[model samples]
Target: MGRIAVIGAGMGSLATAARLAVQGHRVAVFERAETYGGAVGAFRRDGFAFDTGPALLHLPAVYRDLFVKTGKRPLEECVELVQVDPASRHLFPDGTDLALPNASRAGVISALDAAFGAGVGERWGDFLGRARVVWERTRRPLLEDTLREDTAPLGRDPYPALKRGLLRRAPATVAAVGERELRHPGLTALLSECVLSYGLDPRQAPPSAAVLPYMEQTFGSWYVRGGLRALADAVYERCEERGVEFRFGAEVTGVVEEDGRATGVELADGTRQEADVVVRGAPGEPLPGDLGRFVVLLALRGARPADAAHRTVVHGTDAPHDGSPDGPAPTVRVLRPDDDRLVPDAGHEAAVLSVTVPPQGAVDWRAPGYADAFADRVVAVAGAAIPGLAERLLWREVRTPADTERETGAPGGAVPAPALAGADGAWLRTANRGVPRGLYLVGGSAHPGGGLAHAGMSGAMVADLVAGGPGGSR
Candidate 1:
């Protein structure tokens, strides 16, 4: 057994620490903040709670594998998965409303076909099949390996695996992939939605990411009962039970290296913790990856329109008055598909509303009067869905790109990492690794791009590398 220290207690760090500890290695984690979860963290105010990051959860299989590695089952006991219905409703300018399901391939296809005209379903299916192939081919090479040995050493290329007929040809961007599969512009819009969910533009994202929408629509979007944070907390709890120690409020400043090998981490306070292995879960340098900014406003009381479909619903005063006939009234609407807005302001209840903006650079995001102007624009866009959504004036909040970077160390506050669009950018992302012999890199920034499942698998792959050497187990 070896002593190991994991930097940052996000999902990736937790996964690594858990696996190492279960392997009988002594593991300790240092978190800059008082809590874990990094971007997946949560906060509360006035008896209401909100998830600060990763509001939508998908690919429970990744969490399942982590639990299994720790000698436990994830679903039956740890966290109960709540399947989302009508995953989200897409509101189009042409007055067409499409409801997407979490795991109903037919439902998604049918909805698109019904709204967009004939033959769209089959095309969508074919596009999804291509995505599935890519998933199979890349899952192991990218998700299950570090993709690099250490910093300054870029490791092996995973392209040969895809070239072996296991995956499809990857386009430079999601738009390119969708354009190749379907001729309809709406179909392209549907595919671009996947890019938005990952905080990227289809024109700038990797074609490999085209599989994400299929994953969400086929596997079903899910949420933990207490919110997504429960997943992080559960992982942390399991780690503790298995003898992992966590040091909160320890902001890591630098990686301690010897002979070009990572040996430990130096905290912001100058405390150096040594270990047989080290994992970096936070970004050290800023990059033009995925960026996200959100404003969350909560209502202290009263139920509102929720469920998977809420993500795309166009909020409006005329929103379907689907209030509960038997309990507290509830109504929610999606005002603008591109930006977040509420539909109606009329109601004698409390509610929480969230508005998300596209990913952009720090300086561009902070240009004078951007926040106020953006908020006003959202209100205007939502005016159609909710007649008085802007007037509801209960509470309001905003998160700038800089704030997101400060909070999560996410390069330029990007979420789900940037797609491996260009060969150069892809190589740059894949180049860094552990500086010391025993250390490694395993997170969204490492390989297979970002996503909960991919990052978790990255950690497991690193453990496998240590156990079986760089060649990996046969």
Candidate 2:
């Protein structure tokens, strides 16, 4: 059995450790932080808890496969998985409210039609139909298989350009598709918001971005009982069960290499842990930051409404892209879980408010009074859905990219954008294999890019690479 060293006890690293352990490889995980779940972390204060990273999970089958392949117990046995029905409630700038049902195409169609017009549903359904082609064409090469050095095939947009009567071609960018197909301003914003949520610019993102909404609306959005961190905890426990050892507060300074082949990791303490393979779960260099979120945790005075949707998205206005806080009202996501575990008691509610903004390097996210101003703008935007939200705020907690950087160790507190298929496939992430003979990359910054599900895919690719060689069995 080969000895494997995994850097960062993140979801991807943990998945790699667990899978390798099950395959008879000895795995040890090293985490710089005291806890696991790199970007997927939880924060608690004053008896209330909030998920500081991703608040929901889409395409859960990735984790489900990891659990089933590694142990007798399934994912459901590890965490209480609840499908967030009405996956999201969207409030458009025009006062349009749409509660899109989870995983039910028909239900979503009806919801859009009811909220907008009869044919609006048909148009969106048609767009989804087109997006399905993109997902099918790109899913295997971009997600399932190991990313190749010449990923130009995956980079070229697979979204089919529809022939509209006299026109021979369809739209190019995601924003163009919204304008041409969706027609209505509110509907266009709905589609754009999907890409924006991923830290992608809808204006520049390819039409393949349709896959973002398609994947979520098709597979469904879910939440663990306590929080996403609970799922991480379960994965960590599963790794422990499989004899994968972990050392918290173990900061890896650099890769210990022999003739360009990674042999192990050099820790901050000057001690070295040797292994046959090294899986890097942490992010690489920062690109001029994409979309970073400003989070506000609100402890409300009353319980969350029984019929409340788990997520709500407020679309922003098309303001100029000047480098200022008041440039444009950023898109906002508000999550309120029905589970009482997040709050202090049954009488109160804990809600998380997140607004997508430019990365810290692009903006002075930590300037004096910047936090309060951004928080007020976010609260103002979200107030459309939650009446008297400003008053209902018993207390609030704000977290920005600086907080993210402090937690994940990624430079500039930059959050990695999910890999996209466009810009000459510029969005394609680094390959899993061929870094060196023994070095490999895992987690959101690697192949298939970041996001809960995409990171799991990266782990699967890396595990396969090490277990079966570069051309390993997947």
Candidate 3:
């Protein structure tokens, strides 16, 4: 069996290592961080815990499949998985609040009808129906299978919108589709904000991106009993059980390529470890694309109301955040999990408020009081989601893009765009198989692309390529 050198201890990287080890290969994971999880990290203060990265899980079947394949215990046996019922609550500029039901299309339509009016729900439902078409079309080739070198076939969208004349001229982007189909401004915001949550600009995102909302709405959003970070820990533990080694605080400086084939990795300390397969799990190539989030973890003084929504998005009003009076208002996502594990006690609540901001190149996240000032503005917007938020606040901690860069090693804290159909393949991530034979890319920056489920799919594809399993490499 070949020795595998995985670059980071992230979810995808760990998933790859565990699966490869189960296939009878030797795997060792090296991570620069002190812990296993790369971005799936947690923060604690005064006994209150908050997820520093993704707080919710969508499409947990990816991990469930991983557990079933790698060991006897299923995912639920490893980590207590619970479905968040309300999925999300949306707040609009017109003071309309809609609590969307998880995996319940009829219920969602009803909620939208009750809030937005009679036909608005029907319009959104129709849009979702189209989005489902997008999902079914691309789910297999773009996600389940590995990307081939030709890549031309993948660029041709399976959206079936243009030739079919779904619209006047086949809307160029998500926003365009939303504008044409969801004529209501509020509906446009809902569709746009859903894309924005993925760090994509609805104005530029391909219509194929609709698969994101489709996947979530169909599969439903979930949470672990502890936190999303627990999922990563479970994968790491599974790796250990399979005899996959982990080296913390070990950073890879470069891949040792010989004659167009990866042979080993060089550590930051000038040490070289030979391996037959080298996987790039961490982000090294800095692509200056997509906006990221500004997170504020609030430890509040009151218990979460029984009826309070789990996730609430305050749609960006026509406002700005760069101290300029003009740009569109940044979308804010507030997550207040009902799990008692997150709060200090039954008397208090722990919540996270995240705002999508322009990338570091576009916005100064480190200007004097930039993060703090921006955090204050985010809190103000979040108040729309959490009533009487100002009074409930006990203390708040802010996380900036700089913090992201420091933690995840993504240059300028730039987030990666999820794999989409159009953009002339510009949005296509690097293939799971790297240019050099034996070197592979497996993570958010790689094929399939970001979000927990996509990352898992990327790992599965990479493992398949390594094991000569289904969808073997070219």
User: In order, what lDDT does every prediction score?
Assistant: 0.61, 0.82, 0.82
User: lDDT tens digits, residues 1-474, model 2?
Assistant: 999999998888998889889989999999999989888999898889999889899888999999999999999999999999889999887778889988999998899889998888888999899999988988887788887767768767888756465766756788888887778887788887778778777777788888998898888889999999999999999999999999999999999889889999999999999999998987787444256767888888877778877899877853212235657777778888988899899888888888766666677767888878778888888887676787778988888877788888877666777777866776777777745689888887887887998888888889988877552224
Off by over 4 Å in 2: 163-170, 287-289, 318-325, 469-474
lDDT of 1 by residue, 1-474 (tens): 888878888787787788888888888888888888777766555444556666567777778878887865555498766766667776656677677766888877788888888789888887787777656765544444455434232222222212122466545556776676676867776676565556555566566666567667777777676667878888889899899998898888988888877788898887888876777777545345454644434332222433324355443221111111232211222312111112222232232333334444534566666665554444445444444555544554555555677787776666655334234444235422555676676666765456676667666766676665552211
Q: Which stretches of candidate 3 lie over 4 Å from their true place?
A: 162-167, 286-288, 318-328, 470-474
lDDT of 3 at 185: 86
Across residues 127-171, which tens digit of lDDT does each residue of candidate 3 receive? 888888888777777778887778776676555453235445676
Q: How many steric overlaps are in each model, in order? A: 25, 2, 0
Give the 10-residue window scoring lowest on summed lDDT in candidate 1.
316-325
Q: How many times do residue backbones clash in model 3?
A: 0
| Structure candidate 2, residue pairs in collision | 155-425, 444-450
